[model samples]
Target chain A: MSFELFSNLVGAFFTLCIFSFLYKDNPFYQAAEQMLVGISLGYGLVYTYNRVFVPYVYQTIIIQHQFVLIIPAIMGMLYLLRFSRKLGWLSRYPIAFSMMGVGMGVPMGIHAAILVQMRQAMVPIESFNLFLIFIGTIAVLLYFFFSKAHKGVYGKFVNVGKWYMMIGFGASFGLTVMARISLLIGRIQFLVNDVIGILK
Target chain B: MKKTIPLLIVIVGGLIWVVWAFSPHYVLQEVFYNQFYLPWAYASASFAMLLGVLSLTMMHSNKIKMRAPKWQYSYFFFASFVITCLAGFIGGIQKGGLFMWMFENVQMPMSATMFSLLAFYMASAAYKAFRARSPEATVLLIAAIVVMLAQVPLGVKLSKHLPTISQWILDVPNLASKRGIMLGVGLGSVATSLKILLGIERSYLGGD
Candidate 1:
């Protein structure tokens, strides 16, 4: 057989091996899982080294003669120091710096997620649908307000918030189911079209 | 000294990022982050993956040393890892290469199979948990059914209005609550980031 055909058959076998888990866990599924973990890790390491480490550090520092990049180069080495029992504390420096980058980036996320969302919530309320949306948003936000006791007039609004949140969660769950089903359909398509050649 | 030094680094590094974000100066925005911070971050991230690989290797090695159950399977992991690394490094990732061939034949199918298995779990979950136990549950069940049915071709055949009602439900009530929760989470993240920057939360430093 041609290499392409052989590869497709192997892929089909592996797919069936994993699907065997639906019946119950077996050696076939276990072997497939282990091979996947090892191969994925290997792929990640080589990809990172080739794409990121080479271009950024090797080329920039050595060839370009940018000695300044050595600072982060040292920091990156220090990250590996975590493997050492005694010198593990040194890893915290790089971790802290990376966390700082992550922390500082949060403001941009807040701008997009919160500020923009709040802005979008400000509808003209010309229609009943718009008004209901406006009220639903406010009520839900109030539900998350932990300081106030849920009683009296405020409690009624909180109840409305609870209902809205439930409906929202239900919709999300439905979407999730659809997404999973789509994945199943994709696998079935592969099995039928590629493996069995039942479909063109 | 260890904890104190890391905290200082966090504060200084965080301040630079904040300054870079808020400041519109060409140097801060363009030169500082793009030139300096980004390369360092990328280098750090690349090296960080080594830590994960090392941890995995040590775990499996120790498992083999102890003669743990399924110790033979660890050999599969080690051999696969070595073979893949050799293929990738020697062959390169170009089209029709061994690396690409292995990835297509092995990794892709396995990942899809694993993800697809979630469909069975979700179906079982929906069967059990989707009952109309209360007023809220009833609303949730009805909304879920409407949304699910609207997605399939059979639903359109059942009723043209199913899709419209599902869209309305999503566009109005769902968006409102989703926005509300997201706003809260965004604000909370900003607050936590500030706490971390200020050195109030030192858990990242590992221990007391």
Candidate 2:
């Protein structure tokens, strides 16, 4: 058989091995899972080394002779010292560096996630549906606000919030189930089309 | 000294970015990011993955040394790692090479199948857990049923309006609640970030 055919057969076999977990955990499932972990890590490492390390560090510094690049290079190296029990404290520098950068990007997050969403929620009340959405959004927000005692008029709004939240959760769960089913469909397609050649 | 120094680094590092954010000048925004921050972040992220790789190696090696249960399977991990790395290094990562071949034949199928198994587990969960015991449970059940049925062609055939109702349910109350939750989460994260920068949150310094 050609390499492509052989590879497709192997792929289908492993795919079945993984699906065997629905029956019960077995040696085939364990082997496939272990191989997955190893392969994923190996693939990630090679891509990072080739794409990031080689281009950014090796090419920029060694080939191009940008001596200033040594600063971050040393900092990155320091991150590996976390494995050393004695020098693990040094890794916090790089950790802090990355965290601070992420922290400073919060304004952008607020702009996109909060301001934009709030803007979208502020629809013109031309339709009763728009008005319902407006109330639903406020009620849901009030549901999360735990400072006030949930009684009287406030309690009624909070109760409405609960319904909205439940519907939201239901919608999300439905989407998740659809996604899972699609993934199963994809695997079945592979089995039939590629492995058995039935579809062809 | 350790805690103090890291906190100082966090403050100083944060201040640099905040400064960059406010700095509207071309040189400050473009030149600074390209010259300094971008390279540092890239190197830091790559090293971060190396830390993960190191931790996994250490954990597996220790397990192997003690001959833990399923220790033989650890060999599978090591063997696959070696084979994959060898393939990538020796033959390159593009098509027709061993690396891409192994990825297509082994890694992609395994991950896809593993994720697809969730469909079975979720189906089982829905069977056992989706009982209507209360008004709230009944509401959730009906909404879930409507959405689920709407996804299939047979459901649409059964009732022409099923898809339209599902779309309305998702687009209205569902979206409103999601936006509310998103706002809360966004504000909470921003607050925590500010606390971190201000040294009020020192959990990242390691100790409880």
Candidate 3:
């Protein structure tokens, strides 16, 4: 069969197989799930090898052929020792290194990007609709504040916060609904366009 | 003598890398990124992948040895895993080969299948969850129905006004709510990262 015909046939079959899961769990869904996991893993491994290891290692060791590459390469090899119970302790060296690296990187990375950005977002700007901005900002901030008791003078502010929070949640719920609706429309379109070819 | 020294090195090295990242000097940044960061990420990820594969192998091997009832399925899984790995290893040399074929044909279809299943699952879940039993649920059900109807061309043909309402619901209120959620999420993430950085959340290190 032609590639187009083959693709159309396979697409239709997959669409049905996926929909079949609604009735009950079956071998088809299981097969599809397992195949997906395997393929994704396989692809990820290949991509990583090409993109990361080759450049980093080959440049240092083979091309530039620096002696320093040997240290990291050996450290990397120690990771394989994890499979052996006796040598598993060696694996911890690489693991510890990775954990420390990530732990250290995250905070430093977030310092400017997250903290600075958040502070900027909170800082109100002058606008003609200052009342709305003021109300929204103060109410949102009040919604988060929990150190002191929210009563009397603070109670009114807390109530305003409650209203803003509710509106925020309501709006979020509405967006989620719309997103799901869009997804549903896309599937229906697929069924119409690909399966029946009516749209075509 | 053996483990303690390595652990200390890791800790000290990690602190140095963090400090270097925030440093104003270009030399420190170059050393961290080129010499340390990229290599470390790759090496760690590779090891993690290897560990995952090993666990998969061990699990299936045990199932086979014990003659489990679903051993046949495990065998299928193992066979597929080995075949795919071999294909990848071989096909990596050639740009478009058996590995690429399997990925595009077998893998892509399966992923699409899994994704499409979400539609049916959502429908059933919505049927159960979106009951208009209370004032809140009623509002939810109404919003869902309106959104769902407005998405389809049929809704547009039925009433031109609905699309505008849907757009408003999505743009104004939805955008505001999303921003609020994002702000909360951002704060939570910052807190968690700080905790991890300070060694307060040492659970990630595999225990106390």
Candidate 4:
């Protein structure tokens, strides 16, 4: 068989292996999962080495004569020392570096998610939908606010908020299933058009 | 010295970004952060990925050595990893190479199939659990049905207005609830970050 056809056949096998899980878990599915994990990790390693390491580390410090780049390079290499027992403690420095980077994003998240979303919700009520949305936003916020007792008028808002949240979750579930169904259709198309040569 | 230095590093390293956010000084923004800190992060991330690969390989190797249950699958992992790495290094990752062929044939189909499998599981779960016994459940069930119908051509044929109503449900109440959740989460994270930066959150430091 030609290489292209052979590739298609192999693809069909893996697809079938995964589809087998729908019926029940079996060795074919397990093997396919393990192989995928290995292959993707391998591919990621090579891609990272070529894409990030080559230019950022190797080319920058070695060829471009940027000596200061060695600081982070050394810090990066500290991860390898994690395998050593005594030197393992040294890995915390790099961990702290990465964690600090995460910490940095807190303000960014506050600005983007909190401030921006709040501003977006505060638009003037030009339409009926806007009126509902404004009340929904306030009600949801009040529902989450646990400082005061959820009694009296606050309790009523909380109920409306709960309804809004339920509807929101249901919509999310529907969209997610639709997305997965589309992916299912894609795999089915490949099997028919590529493997069986029936739908081409 | 080890503990003190790293803790100090955490505080200083964290404060640097916070300073960058508020200050926008030329030195902090263009000089130090862009030129120095960014590359450090990239290099550190690459190493972390390598660390993950190494850890997984070691785990599988140990599993084979111990002859654990389903250990036979470990060999397949090794073979796949070795073969893919060889293909990538020897043939290069350019188009039409062994690496790309393996990825196209083996990886993409399997991954896509794995994700698509969720559709069946979700459908089954919905069938088993989506009983509308209460007023709240009735609202949820109705919303889901409306949205799902709007996703296909059948909905348009069924009612012409189904799609518009679905869109409004998503745009209004759905968005409002999501915004509330995001605001709550953002506030919590900001508090935690401040605690960490100010040295109040010593749980991360661990061991005295």
Candidate 5:
């Protein structure tokens, strides 16, 4: 067979290997799973080595002799110390450095997620749709409020919030299912057209 | 000394961000952040990815050595990993060759097929679990059906306004409720970060 045909056959085989899981988890599925894990990691390892380690660390510090860049290189090296038993405590330095990034991200998160979201929701209720949306947003917030018991006039608003949340979740579920279905359709198209046409 | 210094690093780093946020000065924005902090974080992420690769390698090797349950699968892992690494390193990943071919044929199809399997399982889940036991459940089911139908031509055929109603459902209630959830999460994130910076949350240091 030609290389293109051979490639299609290999693709068809692995596709079948994965689809076998729909029936039951057999060696075929397990083999494909293992292959996926291994190959993805290998791809990641090589990509990171080339794309990241090369220009960022090796080229900058070693080749260019920008010695200040070695600070993070040394910090990065500290991560490998995690493999050592006695020096495992040193690994915390890298962890802390990583956490610094996370901690610093709080102000950004507050601005984008909370403040901007709140501002976006605070639109003037010019129409029925806007009124519904504004009310729905308020209700959802009230539903999340736990200090007050769900028994009074305010509780009614909370009940409305609960309905809006259910609708939101349902919409999300529907979107995800349809996306997966489209992906399935693409794979089936590949099998029906590409694989079968080559055989013919 | 090891633990204390790391804690201090997080606090001092976080405080710098707080200062940057409030001040908006060029030195903090350009020199300190863009020049120093970003590159350091970028380079560190590479080392982190290397750790993940190493961790997987160690796990598979140990599994094979110990003859763990379904340990034969580990051999497949090693073989594929070695073969892929050899292909990439030897053929050169930057140019189109064996590595690209394997990735296009084996990886793409298998990954897409594997995820597509979820559609079948989701169909099963929707049928078995999504019962309209209460008014809330009924609303959820109706909304789900409407949203799913809106994607295809059949829903439009059934009712001319189905698409409009579906869009309204998404743009109004769905967006609003999602925003509420986002606010809650953002608040929690800020609180957690503050606790971490203040040394109140020592859990990251492998403590209670």
Candidate 6:
């Protein structure tokens, strides 16, 4: 068969496999799910090795013959010791180091991007909007404040916050719903355009 | 010796790495990235994938030996796994071939299906949630109805104003709520990372 015909056939079969899940769990769906996982893991491994390890370690250590790569290379080898129960404790050195490294790296990276941006977002852009911002901020703060009962002067502020919070939640829920609906629409479009080729 | 030595190394090494990452020196940053961070990520993920493959093989092999009712299904799974892996290995040799085909044909559809399943679930969930038993429920019901109706062409045909209202709802209120969520997520992530860095949350290491 021609390549286009072969691809179209494969696409049709996959669309069927996906739609089969709607009828309840079945062999086809299970196969599709497992295949998906296996392929993703396999692809991810290859990508990581090629894109990261090859250039970083293989070139620097193997080709350039750098002695500094030895330490991390040894650490990498130590990770395989996890297969043994007695020596597994040694493996935690690498795991802990890596986790800590990532833990430290993420915040250091994110602090400037997310935290700073959020603080900026919280600050109102307009003078007239400051009142709304102040009320919204105070009300939201009061809603979370559990140290004292909001029954007196703070009660009104708390009420305002409660209303704003409700509106926020409602809007979030609405967006989430729309997102799901769009997914459904896209699937339906695929079924028509690709699988059955009715739209063509 | 088992716990103390490893914990101490982690504590000292972690601090050093943290300092190394934030330092303004370009050389220190490059050393950390090339020598420590990248290699560590590759080693951990590779080992995890090996464990996953081993588990998959073991599960299927057990089913086949026991003559389970779904033994054929296990065989199919094992065959698919082997085929896909071999395809990827072979395709890697040639730069592009069977692996690309399987990814585009099999994997993408499955991902799309998994995401699409959320639609039916969300619809069912919304149906149950929007019962107008109280004033709050009534308001939610109305809001959901408006949003849902506004999304479709039918709603727009019925009222010229709905699309504008939908845009407003999405842009102003939706943006505000999402920003709030993003802030919460940011704070939570930072808190969790700090806990991990301080070695307070060591559950990720898979031991007491």
DockQ (CA atoms), all models: 0.74, 0.75, 0.32, 0.75, 0.77, 0.39
Model 5: docking quality category: medium
RMSD of each: 1.7, 1.7, 4.3, 1.8, 1.5, 3.9
Q: Write the per-residue lDDT of candidate 1 for residues A81-191, one digit (tens) a residue.
A: 887888999999889878887556667867887889888889688998889899999999999998999999999989899999889988998888888889899999888
Better of 2 and 6 by lDDT: 2
Which ten-residue region of model 3 chain A has the weakest summed lDDT? Answer: A128-137
Off by over 4 Å in 2: A198-200
Which candidate tops DockQ?
A: 5
Candidate 1 residues lying further than 4 Å off, grouped into runs, are A198-200
List, residue by residue over A1-200, the lDDT tens digit for candidate 3.
56655655665565566566777877766555555666676676676666666777666578876667667667877777777767777776776667666545556546654565456445555753434444554556566767877888887776665554544454445455556555555656666776577324
lDDT of each: 0.87, 0.85, 0.62, 0.86, 0.86, 0.65
By DockQ, the better pick of 4 and 5 is 5
TM-score of chain B of each: 0.94, 0.93, 0.83, 0.93, 0.93, 0.76
Q: Give fnat, all candidates.
A: 0.74, 0.70, 0.24, 0.74, 0.75, 0.30
Measured with C-alpha atoms, the lDDT of residue A90 in candidate 6 is 67
Q: Which pairs of residues clash in candidate 5, taking residues 3 or more apart in a chain or in different chains?
A: none
Give the DockQ-based CAPRI class for model 1.
medium
Tens digit per residue, CA lDDT, model 2, A68-98: 8777778888888887778888888888777
Tens digit per residue, CA lDDT, model 1, B1-208: 7898889888887888888778899898778778878887876777888888998999899989999998888888999899999999999988689898889889998998899899899888877887777899888888888898999999899999999999998999998889888888888888888888888888888964
lDDT of 3 at B161: 90
Clashing pairs in 4: none
Tell me the docking grade of candidate 4. medium
Find the 10 residues in a row with the least total lDDT in model 2 chain A: A100-109
Winner of 3 and 4 under TM-score: 4
- After superposition, candidate 3 runs with Cα above 4 Å error: A7-15, A81-86, A101-200, B1-14, B67-69, B93-96, B132-172
